[model samples]
Target chain A: MARIEINQSLCKGCALCTLLCPEELIKIGNQINENGYFYAVFTENGSCKGCALCAKICPDVAIEVWK
Target chain B: MSEKKIFSRPKTLKDAPFHFCPGCHHGIAHRMVAEAIDKYSLREKTIGVASVGCSVFLYDYFDVDVIEAPHGRAAAVATGVKRARKDKIVFSYQGDGDLASIGIAETVHTANRGENITIIFINNTVYGMTGGQLAPTTLLGQKTTTSPYGRDFMQDGYPIRMTEILATLEGTAFAARVAFTTPKNINMAKKAIEKAFQFQKEEMGFTFVEILSACPTNWGLNSIDSMKRVEEEMIPYFPLGIFKERKAADVL
Candidate 1:
């Protein structure tokens, strides 16, 4: 199974990926990053399926989803 | 290279009773945007920011979700909406006064941040909403309410070339100025707009489309006269074409 990793510092908490993902795989995490902004991280159900849905939904062009 | 002429424009535009005056370039610009969204299949996901000045009614014009911002705040509002809903294609429609004058700060910062959004700036030289007062892009020696005689360079300074100004910023990924002066120029503007949108889809950076539109009523010129002015006068001051372009290689 493929997983997702977010460069927390790069994430701007747009939540676009979290919203557009057909599967509830990504979400805003409780912790903040170096930028002091809330970042999305992986969880138990975090298998991304490599659909690139996360990448497609990012506005700042921040997310990079790989298989 | 030869390109394909896309299909006809959206039917929504065909609806009669257009609020705009005859020969106003806003009509063409609006269709261009809708055509681009249709070609890219972004209709359902696109959200537009309606700006101040004459184009404020953009919300009613476009067949998409539109949000309004205070004069010159469209970029910042668009940034927020785009950030919150990343899947949606976001763009801001602004006039010269709105974009180049009151909103210069937002415009510069948004381009610097490369927020993956499109800015459609209409530079018609004069402010259409409040009266034909001189705009930031108002041509030198052009008469306006503020400059009753003409825009004296000594007092008012020269017209701002927005695309040129934005192109100098390192954060700007794509910046181009286009005009709706003639059929030939319209085609060029279409290609430039396509390229601007493509940059965002490819995750390059920010994109701006500066259109030298015509404000016939505010300009104190009839349709033909304004069109001629756009072709003969405005083009000289605000020439068209891509000012800056960067491929993925340049970024990484």
Candidate 2:
């Protein structure tokens, strides 16, 4: 199993991770972060493959993954 | 079960949020450089030289000691820093306008002199901090604040390939151009940065890593589209690869 955490306040909601996630588990959430951007969130439960594609492509270093 | 942490903020980076515009790749580049410093355990001895342009605040982001250099003079300042303290690991973070336009002479001479320093060059094709003026790396026909009619080769000349040019000099130990538009590219870029830092640590000649970064605010495009532009447009002109590498024997 893989665990994912996103620093919501630091996320810029660029959605590059959303587009890069192989499992499509990441998505841009409706709730706005403190920076006024719609940050990305893990949507599907237990679907994370821990590929870390999202974390790798996150320009802001907003995403973290543990496997 | 307590999950082991696989990814998190690098120790060399500060906790404060980045001030870069949304979708800008400076944050990624900064994180990579910080990670490299952490990997080598150079946090205590590393001295970063921050140059002008969008990345002028580089000192605030990195945890190590950093000095601000005037526009296009980061190489000169870094030279002085490295010379003063040979025990310290020194690196410079500069933009295209600072490195290739106004500071090209300093950049060339520093590299030619074989300074044991690493240079992280951000090539966004435009002057990002000053409202998107044309830069030395701006592609032909690219539109910018100064080049409203588009960059005409006849009028503006050609986009200068600094990495390729620096590769020809005898002083360069390692020179490569990398992009950060995708996960694979980011990984490659990280490897390149690590190698560059390793070379500096070994006291090899000058090392340069040119990262093709995204500037959505300056490019007048959305984040995703700006990233696409890097792949579809910029890659054709810049061509990512190691332009030069010095073997152990070559360094001696």
Candidate 3:
């Protein structure tokens, strides 16, 4: 099992993670964040491979992965 | 089971949010440089020269001793700093407009002199800070504020390839061009930056890493489209690779 956490405050809703996630578990949420952007939310079904691709591509450095 | 944190913000970077545009790649380049600084434990002994342009806020994002240099004079300023404090690791963060256009003389001379320093050059084709003006590295047929009719070879000339040009100089120890269009490329960019710093640590000579970044707001495209443009348009003209790598210092 793997997990990833995204800091909503720092995310600018670029959606690069959603495009890069291999499992396609991350998506832009309907609810807008305080920063006025739709932040990405991970679908927590324990399918994350923890490859850290999203974290690597994130310009904001908002994603943190645990394996 | 104990969980391990795989990736997080680098310590050398300030906790404050980046002031770049929504889809700007300056944040990514800033993070890469910060990560490299943290990896080398250079926090205590590092000085960063902030150049003019979008990356001028480098001093604000990076938690290091930063000196503000006049437009395109980062290399010259960096040379003075490195010479004054020989023990400190010094680097300059410059954009294409600053490095290739206004500061070409300083940049080329610094590489020719083989000053023991590192330069992180960001090339995004247009001058992002100056309202998408034409830059020295702007691709042919690219439309900018100054070149709204598209850049003509006869008028604007060809886009200068800084990495390839710097590699030809004997004093340059390492010169590589990398882009962050993909995760794999982003990782490789990080490694290139680290390698440049490593060579500087060895007192080899001037090392330079040119990063092809995307400026979404300035390019009049969304974040994803701007990134795609880098892959489709920019990469073709500016091929990414190690242009030069000198293993040993040249005997003067």
- TM-score for candidate 3, residues paired by index: 0.97
Give the whole-model CA lDDT for all candidates, comma-separated: 0.76, 0.92, 0.92
DockQ of 2: 0.79
Per-residue alpha-carbon lDDT of model 2 for B21-76, expressed as tens digits?
88888998999999999999999999999999988998778899999998899999
User: lDDT for model 3, on a 0 to 1 scale?
Assistant: 0.92
Q: What is the C-alpha interface RMSD of model 3?
A: 1.0
Tens-digit lDDT string for candidate 2 (A1-67): 8968999999989888887888888888999977789988887588787888788788888888898
List per-model TM-scores for chain B: 0.93, 0.98, 0.98
Q: Which stretches of candidate 3 lie over 4 Å from their true place?
A: B249-252
Ranking by DockQ: 2, 3, 1
* Order of candidate numbers by TM-score, starting with the best: 2, 3, 1
Q: lDDT by residue for model 1 over A1-67, one digit each (tens)?
A: 4555566665656454665566787788888877666777656454546665454334233445544
Question: Any runs in candidate 2 off by more than 4 Å, and if so which?
Answer: none
**How many angstroms is residue B45 displaced in model 2 relative to the true structure, after the best TM-score fit?**
0.1
| Residue pairs with clashing backbones, model 2 | none
